[model samples]
Target: MKAFVIERYGKQEPLHLAEVPEPKLGEQDVLVRIHAASINPLDLKIRSGALKRILPLRLPLVLGNDLAGVVTQVGTKVQRFKPGDEVYARTDTRRIGTFAEFIAVAESNVALKPPSLSMAEAASIPLVGLTAWQALVEKGNLRKGQKVFIHAGSGGVGTLAIQLAKHLGASVATTTSSANVALVKSLGADIVIDYKKDDFAKTLRDYDLVLHSLGSEELEKSVGILKPGGQLITISGPADPEFAKNNGMPKLVQMIVGLLSRKIRKKAGKQGVGYSFLFMRGSGEQLSTLGELIHSGAIRPTVDRVFPFEETNEALAYVEGGRTRGKAVIQVVALANQA
Candidate 1:
């Protein structure tokens, strides 16, 4: 199958399209014919080798994280899904290759796509949706009537998070540019802070949870806004020692992470708040819950644009530009008139 792959890691390097052998299907895997895939900031980070120490990928790697596809075959031990089942997934981190025409995903990490969404829409949900689910529900334990702050409210994760927080009955606040204030509000953000015009940290206070996805400065500010005993979960970060230990990094790496996050962790402790880093993992169970939410209209996929398969690199560039309102998808399967 023809797929786009990075021969080496470099920020300016382009992905080369090449014919490659099919992925080997495991006993617990399902072979999927990918219809659409989504671009993520993690893809850019991986391609640039920014995460080399933490997430070492084999050279000439295929680059994509989320996909919506149809099952073409099922492994011997796979029982939850069968051939012809429509599904979507954030492929397990170690087995990522959703940029291709097909992928063999572990059955435990795959979920049926919501019938209410198109393939492109479904593709946009898994990664960002799962990120929100893990951050808010699993880690934050955000409850009804509580206040939560989500940064970058117009971005991929932020858009879905706002909806999910609202679905969980939390009063949501978010930071976005003036142009996107309306967009975030439409997604159920009760308070939209225009970051370009105002300082969110100075204006918002006593939040039960702060989902921090920005720089160190913003993260420090996020800690101040959280009430005592509140959680400050950061997706972009100086990975803390807890995350390092949980992921089983080398002792040296764990020490490095601890030192990097020492300042923020100490500040959080002084203020009686908790701080931790989150690197979301794939989970079929979580995706199933998200699918129900999408199907019920409690949440909706926000697709900013869809590029043709051949323009996959362009899609990545667009996402990296950081002007997108929501997620960007690549239509992998050619339409009737396309070459």
Candidate 2:
């Protein structure tokens, strides 16, 4: 299989195209012939070694997380999928290597691709879609008619989060710059705050939930805007003890997070609100549910750009710059054209 791999962590210059041996499938895994793969901020962080402590990596690592592909083979225990089945998934972070001609993903982390989308579109949906779904629906338990705020409404996760929140019947508010206000609004954000000009914390108030993607400073201020006992979920850092326990994090990581939470927790406490951090895990069941939503037009994939397989570096550069309005995808194989 052909793959783009990094021979070393830290330097972007080390990323190079190379031929590698295909992954040996485990009893619980399936081999996927990759059609498209999406770039994510998490990939950049991993490539730069920013997550070394939390997610250790070996050298010459292939870097990608979300993919849409066709099943070429399935392990003995994989009864849900078979050869020729089209699937999409947010692959496990520990084994992610989707920037390739193929991937071997655990069956538990694979889902049937939404029938309504192309491979590139399907590839863009998984990671960010799962993140939004887990944050708002699973963890936050956002209710219909309730107000929910999503930060970075024009970004990958924000775009999907806005649509999902609306589909669930929640009145959604989102933050974006002035240029993207119209885009977010069109996607179903009832209110759009221009983060560059206006302070969202001061302008928006009495929200039932705040899906925050920014840093700790913005997260702290978000509590003031929440209605009493409302929840504030951040994807950035400082994990909440209660959510950590519920999510079944390792005891050592949980303990370290607990000590850190005292600082942020005290702040949320002062405002009479709940605070938690979100570290999304892959789930095939959740992916299938999201796929159904996509197929039904309840939620749609919003892609800002698509690059050819050879232009993978350029695609990564675009996503790393943080200027993209929505998801960026690399069409790895153009499976439709091959047929």
Q: Model 2, 156: alpha-carbon shift in Å?
A: 0.6
lDDT of 2 by residue, 1-339 (tens): 899999878837546899999999999999999999999888888998877756777878999999998999999999999999999998887898999999999999999999889999999999999999999998899889999999899999999999999998999988898899899988999998898898988889899999998787787788889999999988876777776577567898778779988887898888888887887889999999998888788888889999999889999999888888889999999656745
Q: Give the per-residue lDDT of model 1 (tens digit) for 278-305.
A: 9999999999999989978999999999
Q: Against the hidden reference, what TM-scores do the models get?
A: 0.98, 0.94
User: Could you tell me which residue pairs clash in candidate 1?
Assistant: none
Candidate 2 TM-score over all chains jointly: 0.94
Candidate 2 regions exceeding 4 Å error are 11-14, 242-255
Consecutive 10-residue window with the lowest summed lDDT within model 1: 330-339
- The 10-residue segment with the lowest total lDDT in model 2: 7-16
Residue pairs in collision within model 2: none
RMSD of 2: 1.9
